[model samples]
Target: MHAANVPTASPLRTILLCFIVAILEGLDLQAVGVVAPAMAATFQLDSAALGWVFSAGLIGLLPGAVFGGWLADRFGRKKVLIGAVILFGLFSLLTAYSASYEQLLAARLFTGLGMGAALPILIALSSEVASVGLRNMAVSLTYCGVPLGGAIAALIGLFSVSGDWRFVFYVGGVAPLLIAVLLMLWLPDSRAYRDQGLPLRDTSQALMGQGRGFSTLLLWCSCFCTLTILYMLLNWLPTLLIERGVSHLDSSVIQVLFNIGGVLGTLLAGRLMDKGRALMAVVLAYLGMFAALAALGMVEQLQGLYMAGMLAGACAVGGQLILYALAPRIYPAKVRATGVGAAVAVGRLGSMSGPMLAGKLLAAGAGMSGLLLAVSPLVAIAALSAATLLGRDK
Candidate 1:
């Protein structure tokens, strides 16, 4: 989005509109994992097969992020965002109405494509409107809607009738259509994007120009490693809990706790960054995730699992939110969306791999404890990368 006259619009409206989109996007994203059991029963899906189902949506995200960002830079954020929302909304409906396993996979893949595209724009739009100090907090507040939406998904599942898991998807599907209408009616085109001019810059130039290569690489690395574990937990926590003998209803409650925790953690992180303690926020997020991962594996009781779930949700999702906030500052307004989108696109690869890796290992009979513990090194790597990226001046 190139810059224009900065529109003279209230940032509150943009934040609220972006927040609503994040909520619906999140509901759709997290709905699948919550409904996994029902889909498993209906499709006779084994762990490995289920991994494929999870990855299918994520696979679409990679290209969606790249193209969506590219399109936004070329056209405009509002138009591309509207298109992306409609695409995902339509496919989410398909997911609800899917009658066969293949149909489900196809629907999820396309749904992911739309989601992937919309996310970068959300991050970009949220940041572009705020002052430097407020940008992180603003983005965090907006991004919290994702986990809030996840919590809503859990709630929908909790009250929904058995064998009618499609209800959650139905709600997720329709809400975006309605939100898209709201977006079209009230959401303003990004003023910051409008204020900037010249469309000659491309993704590579946006990311690598102005001596930004190393920091950009670190950002990608951090996002990739962090997102791998983040997504693994997001897509599999319910199933993993059940595998360890927790009841489905209990797992759903835990899922709700996880998402609620995410909302809290993300807000706290953004607040910390706005106060000039970004490095502190980074440390807390990664360390919390490390501890949470270990705890999830060792704790067997419902209370223990619930505690771990909240911790995981906070640290994992909050870590991602930090990256979303930081990515925009790395580039000028001319290519902010492209740079942020590229980083997110790289991170989506990690998201795609995390679920499949867990499923295959679990199918191969690896203990959950070992699997969770094995991720500690990855978390450490991400923490170091993120810290380095933070300390470096953009």
Candidate 2:
């Protein structure tokens, strides 16, 4: 019998490429937030129009994720990733030259489709390339590019010359365009997927087969709950702190601390996953999140608040990365991207809803304590979901 050829490329090399792609995705997505004021002024847009412009991009992401995953499975991950990078890059460049609000909105929507498509493929690729035991760590490490990209956007927004919102778009567009060329030359398709030659399956079957249907549901639920809490903290925690008498500067600083904690938590969780304790680790992580949220509700001092914010971020963001890490293991490589994509699509819904839900609760006269208390139990539910997966193994 002839021996089959195997790809000898280092998985770390692939992970590095995936990281760069993720960072570009982060920068492009975050650029809109920083430039919204300028976009509103240039297009003579009202708050309502601006809100729709923001929403147009997010709306695109839902379908893009689902479609992108399907494409990645059908065509191959590297091809889909390269195409997505170029798609977003071109539209982002178009965004830099948009002459009207409607034009910008359309461009942003297209750009978001590309951006959203790239994320799951990147996660899938990272998971595939990783050595067996280190897949969780590898995915967690590469996913850090997102926050790192956001931090870069904040820096550009702070330092860029006034009335130059377009500069960030230019950077966002150009960098990814260049990176796409590199991906074309250097990125490789998954060896397992390449060897299998599996035909495309129905999306439902891809996600809910081989005794994984219920586990998929549990993962979806965990993703929704954790993402809801994460986005709530991202959008509302500072506002809540400010309302509770924290200064604006301190509120912002706490947000930074929160991200720092998230990075730390990802690192810690990855190691835990390698130890064959992913389920227990994630459960405890969410339990810790509940405690952190409780502390945020009770703490009044600046020092105490700072500690609580970091811990909250550690649990929320770290837990999210853990979910990403777990997703690839639930399916064969042929359908891995689709599976992750569907989960992410669900999570994005929670992302959109979280801030709105928090706002409504606040408007309805929920105190910070009341809000935090309400959120705390949801993490427990998420933990219990992870436990369900654990039970199946036994």
Candidate 3:
């Protein structure tokens, strides 16, 4: 599986390293959401201002993903990933240290730049490292770290002393810096990338060559829609629950349940894909996502809200896993990271817009139910697009 001329590490080690990094990524990505109420209180931020705050980090992700993947293709995934980790770690700490709202936004932007860079490389490395028969499972296992991390962040929020949110950011920042050291010591370069050594392709050729253009568009559409709802909930769920008169502690618990469900859903999505049930995975993920979104708005009881939150997390995360698993297969090895990066960059656009859109909806007098129902149709679009990709992939 590896070239005689290139160094390689065990697939187990590579996947483990990737999983650890993913946990840190997940924690930071979801940290803002869990801490939103406290942070808003600190800065006297209205929902509209908070929306831009959420988007500032997402805006940074775009350039980071585009260029990070391009560099990894040249310098190697390990290096790019390590640098990205360090970059994000430093900036996340800055996020905690910021004395003003403007400083906070700047810190989150730079932190997202680093985080945005790490995700594509993590996906690329996991896909390239595992054997073909186990690729989906490998990627899924690696992705499980993300939700696990989010669960931890929710726990932090739940137990926070004196309503301080910066503490979660501190843990998020420190853990990644520690992990970056471990990655440098143990993580391996992609055996597939090292062995295949295919020539690089132009963006147009890499993503849209031959008759693949339409399918690529479909893939991007599904990814965009999937992330839009996922991040909207991740960033807004707690506030939504609190606004509906749920206690902060209950909101945190619900968020924890959501992440745990995400972990399970990510694993299930991968397993189904590996078993040649990709279509089933698509249907369950998106249709369930649509239903869960509506349920969240309608459910009044705490237990009902818990069920809805868990379902939403599961379906949304599962849908995202489907896209991450599909991206590497659509392009050749050498240009694989770049291709995946482009797809991820588009997804980040959805991620950025989700929070901002929710903010706008709230500003315009939409309740939580109104906001969620409005976005449910996008799940249908995602379902159709992903289903088409499966037929095309075969």
TM-score of 2: 0.91
lDDT of 3 by residue, 1-394 (tens): 2456454568998899899989998888878877787889988999778867777888889999988988888778888999999999999999989899999999999999998999899999999888888899999999889899989877876777436688878877898899998887787777656665654746568678877788889889998999999989988898899999999888888899999999999999999999999999999998888788888888889999898889989999989999999989887777788888888999999987887799899989999988988888888899999999989999
lDDT of 1 by residue, 1-394 (tens): 2244333457888898899989998888878877887889988999778868877888889999998988888788999999999989999999988888899999999999999999999999999877877999999989999999989888877877556878877777888899899888777887766666655555686678778999899999999999889888877787788989999889888889999999999999999999989999999999999889988998877899999999999999999998888898888777778888899999999988887788777878777887897778889999999999988954
Worst 10 residues of 1 by lDDT: 1-10
Residue 208 lDDT in candidate 2? 86
Q: Can you write out model 2's per-residue Cα lDDT over 178-281, one digit (the tens) per residue? A: 99988877777777668658646676876787788998999899888888898788767877898999986687677677767777888788889888888767
What's model 1's TM-score?
0.93
Clashing pairs in 3: none
List residue ranges in candidate 2 displaced over 4 A: 1-8, 158-163
Provide the TM-score for each candidate, comma-separated.
0.93, 0.91, 0.93
- Cα miss at 373, model 3 (Å)? 2.4
Residue 372 in candidate 1 has what lDDT?
91
